[model samples]
Target: MNRLNLFAPDVRENPYPFYATLRRESPVCQVDPNGMWVVTRYDDIVAALKNTQVFSSAGLRVASEPPHLQRHNPLSDSLILADPPRHSQLRNLIGRAFTATTVASLETRMRSTAARLADEMLQRRVVDFVPDFAHRAQANALVQLLGLDPSLQPNFQRWTTDILSVAAISPDDERRMQDVRRSIDEMEQYMNDLLASRRRQPGDDLVSGLLRSRVNDCALTDEDLMGFLFLLFVAGLETAVTLMTHMALILARLPGWMDRLRKELDLIPHFIEEVLRFEPPVHATMRLTLADTELSGVRLPAHAVVALLVGSALRDEAKFQDPDLFEPARRAQASLAFGHGAHACIGAFLARAQARVVLEELLSRCRRVELRAERLDWNVSLNTRCPLALPIEVIPA
Candidate 1:
């Protein structure tokens, strides 16, 4: 088989068919010239996630950095890229602050926010939901959650984009590296200032709570604090944006879906579940091997790059019946979309809550969802399969 061109136009459009081919011929084979093993089978992905000892998350920082270029990435201090005791400690602390109770409490206000966002979309007549709606909703929720001013959102998102871009670009891109470093430095300073202000006058927001909370009688230091904040910017809030965009795009492209959802409002959850399985926001996530390991009898060298093809595995034939079909009514089993095991996304509850509330508001207000754009462009990020824009015209109910 020719080395899989994952970013090629055909795969970008829909990768499942290509992934099925991989599962048949090279379940654990390295399909790329880069020697990165793309794991497509459902069972193997789960096993790798659970076996954190061998498939380490720590390798992310190491993998991204050039051998000669050395610098501290605050994300290195986060649970997002750590293992065991440190990971558990960070997860518990952050998790406590983002509890179901705290998130649920935001429902009333969040619902209002979503309605206002939908209203804005309605007024536009023709709107690109990706930026006009999804982006705004994500930013609004993030600002409210962290108790920061919405005016600061542009900078927050810019920093997030710059930092995440580091992973996508070649290590030789010194200018990109410099820009990312600058963003990190500025963000650290900004967070320090924000933390100080919060300390002076505490509030009910997460930042204030994070400051006050203790895990095992130990408070999060600057490193851990910066790491968590960066994670929230880069991964947590962005996931919700991608989920909402994907859901909206699904509704737009699938003619009968909205009517079906409107008739059976209870199917909303299943609809969301199916969208996650069918068009997952995250296509692949990297895991570095801690030691020499074997996957499906294929020996992998220590520190070898293993990309868990979540999008591919979701449609793995052995796992789901009619795997290629977008069947919301299919048995809703846990998907690796948000990930699995210890490193499963901590902000998943928040993302789902946001999606449920926003989609609810959208459905209630809009009678008809029309896809104005004849063609859609997908973003180029290897990890995230987000539409670049989703222009739509909605008829008011």
Candidate 2:
């Protein structure tokens, strides 16, 4: 059987075509030598995500941690990989400090940071959207959210990129594993110091708020705080960076959409929604089968790793008509861009708000954004889809 390998160069570059083929030919097919399955159909993914008992979230750790690291990975202990009661406890306690209101409160800061970055990029006339604007703006937002010193902003992108790359690391790649380990160590030290500083002098940031939160008369342990901070620094920042970069890429590729959005600024939110569906930053999520289960009549053994292809599901013909076309106003069914069920992205609101602010800032200052005639280089990761760099030429308004 020709199993699909998601890490293959060609597939990593553009997995949608392969996803469509899998959904049509074999929706529940093995994608790895370890008997890991890939679920492509929208309905199948939805069912699996909702049935967390059978489809355990422990598979997220399996997909993220290299074999050498195993349970030692800090990210493995985060809220994203927890199940049931434990996940509930963490989410509820953390949710109080990460509400939509908290995100709303950051709008002024977000706008200022975005406007400054946009202005700097526009001054250059030609800029790489990923590093020049998206990375810097998202990093600044994260630092502000965490209430950390502004001096710490420079390493946020590198640390996040290294940490997130572990999701697709080859078990045999000793060099890459070492680099990831070094990054993890450094980030942990930084987080520990930051946490200590917060304890000494709490501020009005999310980290300080998280430090003060408690559940069942017990404050969050140092380990718990470390894991959560790691999650926020890596997943929160990386996802937002990917979202804004992709938005810029889309606008540069389709000048007409940019023109439309620039004129009808009110439609930017809808455009953001469609962008989440059309080209979601996260391409897939992982789950484990806790017990023997059948999906679409195919049997999956207990503990089998399953990859829910969120990218494919968004374009499934059964779910959305003309699934290939970009329609900003299509609100038939909610997209799984931020995921579904219990493990939906806790930072979705923050990410959406940040993207909107940055895009609006750029559009309001620029007449046109166009991509140069250069081949796009996508980041080599199994779970995320985004350009390594998006070089664009901007015409100032």
Candidate 2 residue lDDT tens string, 1-397? 5887777777877778888898889998898646578898999999998998998886567656767654367777788888988888888888877788888988999999988987887889898888888888888888778876789778787788778878667778878878888888888888899999988999888988988887778677787788889998899888898899888888887778878987787788899998898888788888888899998889999888788889999989898899888888785444599889898889999999998998888888988888985687777665788888888988897
Maximum-lDDT candidate: 2
Candidate 1's residue-wise lDDT over 176-204, tens digit each? Answer: 77888888888878888888899999999
> Could you estimate the TM-score for every candidate?
0.95, 0.94
Backbone steric clashes in candidate 1, count: 0
Model-by-model lDDT, in order? 0.82, 0.84
Clashes of 2: 0
Clashes of each: 0, 0
Q: What is the lDDT of residue 54 in candidate 1?
A: 93
Question: What would the C-alpha RMSD of candidate 2 be, to one decimal place?
Answer: 2.0
Model 1 quality (TM-score): 0.95
Task: Show model 1 residue runs off by greater than 4 Å.
Answer: 64-70
